[model samples]
Target: MKGFITDPLQIERESMRIIRGYLQQDWTEKELKIVERCIHTSGDPTLESVIRIHPQGIEAGLKSLQQGAPVITDVEMVRAGIAKKQLSQLGGTAECFLSDPRVADQAVELGITRSMAALRLNKERLKGAIVAIGNAPTALLEVLELAKDPETRPALVVGIPVGFVGAKESKDLLWEEHPELPSITILGNRGGSPLAATCVNALIYLAVNREI
Candidate 1:
């Protein structure tokens, strides 16, 4: 009978040790923390190949968190996954508008997904905020469109929506065409709320630890 590791801190240390042993890339310290958290969340070390980071993404994220910026997410799952308790202490907030009646009504009338309407509805709150999208490609696409203007641009975009439809295309567009935007994403159509949340959590960790 084999014994499982049950201690919380020990588990984290062990998990990170193993993850680092398997991950070998030229990523900076902050980038590696975000990648490791995603890998830990999924229990998949091979994810190192898919995790993409814009050079300024980590820097932007930390700065925003330090400045007490808000986080606008695409769905409830992403919002729930964040470290809100710790984040609030840093004067940061997280919100999701998909559940708003206005989003649903606008989506129905405009023939758009609720996710897209959600982003469209929060242009003002999005400026200088962290935009974390994990489940809806439409929301990510819409954010990119709005981001064309400085007023709606986010401090950093965590665009990692998981699906077979527009997910891959949306992420590819951000990575390939929007190089100037600070963003962290998963390439090739594989992402979810856990990854998105972990990415932000990593940034918060860096901010708290002053890693940058």
Candidate 2:
């Protein structure tokens, strides 16, 4: 147990100090906070290179949270990982519809993924909401497709689905093709629910901007 630190706050501070030593990007403070939180949660220094952030991503998330926008996720795990207690203090909410019977029925009828069906059935909630998609590329793709309607405006999209399938392609399209879309993503198929949840948490941390 030599040189071991048990205090959570001290551990976080030390971890962040070490993480900062390796990150030399010219990102803004809020963007850097997201990067730091991702690196801390993932424990992978290489992620610094693959992380992508749209210019409006951080600001958009912050603004939405401040305005009490709900956070919609593709899966239960991502929803479960969010800081719901803190979000409640801000009058914000988080939800996941994977378990909804409508999701199952729509998925079977449409011959698409349940992740895709969740978004398809909840298009109304996507408007000005914070959408977090961390487990399914199909969901991210569906979100992008719905976003093209000129009415749905997700404040920020944490599109970090981890898989060998359409994960990279979905994020690639979001970062490359859709410049106006507000999103934070990890390129090259390296993502998961934790990253998606923590990315949103980082935005919340910024919104409150105090020791929690």
Candidate 3:
């Protein structure tokens, strides 16, 4: 039997080492951290195949966080998972709009999903902010539509909603229709709040360490 591993730092180090063994190609240090965290969060090594990163996504996200950009999330779970301390140390903050009263009211009034409504309500704040969507594909769709308007463009979008319905389609649209947008995403329906949060946290770590 294996001995108990009580050190959290050592646990993480060992986990990353295991994940590294699964990766065949060599990725940059920053890119490897992002991938490792995703695998660590999901415990699925095959996830590496679906991950897609815009060439400038990491650098853009890091720059935004360093400049004190707000990080917007589609779900509270994602917001809660972010390393807020590290983010604050780098002059950034994370927020989730799903619980906003305005979003609830608007969803009912507009006959849209609360996630979609939430994104619409926060359109102004999304500009130049790092947007992370880990639930509700409708939210990702809304973000893409809003991004078409220059004033609502985000610094970097981490699109990884998980579901059977719109999740795959939403990510496909983000990758295909809006290739110009700075973003990171999993290509199919294999994503969730944890994966999205992991991506943002990796970027924050990169920013905090001045690696970007």
Candidate 4:
């Protein structure tokens, strides 16, 4: 069993060891002490990683995750492997996105980008499954109806084009019918293709960060 130490230096040393293991590297003694002191004062392990990541990088990284669609990582794959065994834990099998050309572009961008990132990151398996749909809001209702079997989980819908005729309504109706649907983030107004790409990239960054 592991033993706890009362000495601040020892505690910091232990934390440094833990951090090194997770970061897959050795830390310089000078850096270790600095990191350890931060931990000692803040009492937050994340702070150590945050320091390594730096504020600008953290902000950019966060923006990438929250604004984009969905992505998976190798960690997620392993998690999915375990989850796949249970009938109820099967990740989403269906997806919905706006049918409007503009709206569809956003949904597709987010979906494709997320898939690419997830493939590269080796997500946590269980938590890494991300679903992307390209159907408008109204179309999503039909998708929900089609995916209603108790065995299949509701699809995650990304609604980026808020005013694409039936698209916005589709999102609302989808929420009403399948409240458990998983989605990364929602956009309130209609966005162009460039915006859609940015959103998708953001989602990929966010999902990977979430696993890390």
How good is model 3 by TM-score? 0.95
* Model 4 CA lDDT for position 184: 27
lDDT of 2: 0.90
| 10 residues in a row with least lDDT, candidate 1 | 203-212
Which parts of model 4 have CA positions greater than 4 angstroms off?
1-129, 133-135, 161-163, 184-199, 210-212
lDDT at 178, model 1: 96
Task: Mark the 10 consecutive residues where model 2 has the least summed lDDT.
Answer: 203-212
lDDT of 2 by residue, 109-201 (tens): 989999999888888899889999999999999999988876776878889999999889999988999888889999997999999999999
Estimate every model's Cα lDDT from 0 to 1: 0.91, 0.90, 0.91, 0.35
Worst 10 residues of 4 by lDDT: 87-96
Give one digit per residue, the lDDT tens place, for model 1 in 110-130. Answer: 999999998898788899999
lDDT of 1: 0.91
Sort by TM-score, top down from the best: 2, 1, 3, 4
Q: Give per-candidate clash totals.
A: 0, 0, 0, 30
Instruction: Select the stronger candidate by lDDT from 1 and 2.
Output: 1
Model 4 earns a TM-score of 0.31
TM-score of each: 0.96, 0.97, 0.95, 0.31
